[model samples]
Target: MHSVCVLGLGLIGGSVLRAVRSAGYPAWGATKSEGDRDAALADGYDVEASVEDALRRAADEDALIVLAVPLTALEEVLRQIRALAPSCPLTDVVSVKGPVAEAVGRILPSVRYVGGHPMAGSTESGWAAGSAELFRGAPWVVTAEEETDLTRWAQVARLAIACGAHVIPATPEQHDATVARISHLPHLFAAVLAAVGAEGGPLAWSLAAGSFTDGTRVAGTRPELVRAMCEGNRSALLEALDEALGRLGAARGSLASTGGLAVTVDAGHEARRGFTATPQAGPAEIRIDLKDPNALDELLDLGTLGGRITSIEDDLAVGEELGNP
Candidate 1:
């Protein structure tokens, strides 16, 4: 694509806009706030005055218009894009895909929109949080419908490649359901753990250990961000919650067995050992989202480049818990 419009110059949107520029595609963004517009411009991301302005500016250009806004704002963006003429392609970076695709279908018959989720983010946000390399080596998920424009889809794939991201294709519903388990559910569980620890006051915090810290890491996510994600994917989140509860029930059953705590301890030990196996080229590239760039860079420099079909050795032979979608 020659040019693209990125709506909502926040973290994910700004990052993609920046990456598009780095990939040599002329890029521009739309934002509601003057401060955001200025910030994104200062960060070297082209800023457009409004959505209509962005679409008009990108008119007749082989460009992609992206709505990087929250899931809550998706419907409005889709409506506006639907009203636009059918020259340029439209896409989105909303975390949940199912609702976004459904909404777009209802309103935009000829508007070619694709759903995407960059499996990367930071604790930070807003236009001031823009970065071109923010998505380097991250998983760039694209979910397309049967009517999706193949040429536009290929352009998006190329964009992902330029950003050093691995491409994973799925349907909108599949993307939503999978993210409910891996992304949304984890956030919920982490917050739950944090609240439990804080329940006992400062003393409880003092007693928290490594496991607690790692397990509850996502609990530190920004409130608005978490609220948006959970609410947007409520249906899948509910299903994820049921599955998590079922796993918890199984663990409880084990703990309540004749051996009780001993069985639990053994199970925990086994779980811990899985991560201890000699670092093998995993059977698959561990496509992970990094809230911190430095952290991901360190791993990459350590020779953990993602996208390999599998690890050099078959670590799965030892029966590690498989991470499902």
Candidate 2:
């Protein structure tokens, strides 16, 4: 197993450290947060004295470096990586992929880097709130581009699998566009919904039920973190936001004219049902030979069709197609 070094020991970072360690891989982490550093150290995990120290060790060991920092902190972290471990195999758990990929390309063009985003998180923040099981069974995307190093990509995918996540191979553009709808848009909606409900005053707060709680849960995430995530993918988020507003406008107009929300309510209900419905048949197995010249293309195509890699054995990538036929 390739040793791992994680920079940023909060939430996702902390969880990655814990999960990788549990999987028997040698792992260590560093963070700028003194509280998180102390807490992780007290829990018996190796917490480096500083980012520089962590990077130096990673360089010496030729360990895979995982960037778990927020988008705002990404450039600074990348600069350190460039200085200390310019040639280390690298990956990240950042929420938005395009901007990170772009930054990496500009800053370390020759570095063996793969972008990743684990589609799992909590409304809570910080090291203490994270669990080793947070990513279990979640869809963790690994960006597959034309220039991606297959060996390094496989290493990153293996680590994700060992940490109990199914890997989704996607281009950074595809990942950003898709997540804008499923993830970032939801965060924005949650924020709006929470604010709107709160404006209903004390009576609304008293009558808050499961629907309200569930809908607004992500609105409770730290404001700075939410801002960084939503703002980082500006172009994609704008497109998703525009579509949402168009639907909302139509719904409002219908409600005002017809005094009925049937169209809006029914459409949402059907979409929700479709999302929750299980497949009647088992997923179809998919295999991609890593040595094939078209392997990266095949991986991206599989992800585009909602396939996920369960594991990689030697040169064979074993996956399954879960989307509708």
Q: Rate the local accuracy (lDDT) of all candidates.
A: 0.70, 0.93
Name the candidate that leads on lDDT.
2
Q: Which ten residues in a row have the lowest lDDT in candidate 1?
A: 310-319
Off by over 4 Å in 1: 257-325
Q: Report the lDDT tens digits of candidate 1 across residue range 1-325.
A: 4677788888888788778888888788887767878887776566777888787776657577777887777777776665663556777788988888778778776676777787888899876676778877777776645555544555665666666675565667767888898889989999998888888899988888899999999898898899898889989999989977976887788777753666556766886686465455434334322223342232223222222211112111011222321
List ranges where model 2 is wrong by over 4 Å.
206-208, 258-262, 323-325
RMSD in Å for candidate 1, one decimal?
8.8
Q: How much is the lDDT of residue 27 in candidate 1?
A: 82
- Highest TM-score against the true fold, candidate: 2
Per model, state how many residue pairs clash. 6, 0
Give the clashing residue pairs of candidate 2, or none: none
lDDT of 2 by residue, 1-118 (tens): 7789999989999999999999999999999999999999999999899999999999999999999998988999999999999989999999999999999989998999999999
Clashes of 2: 0
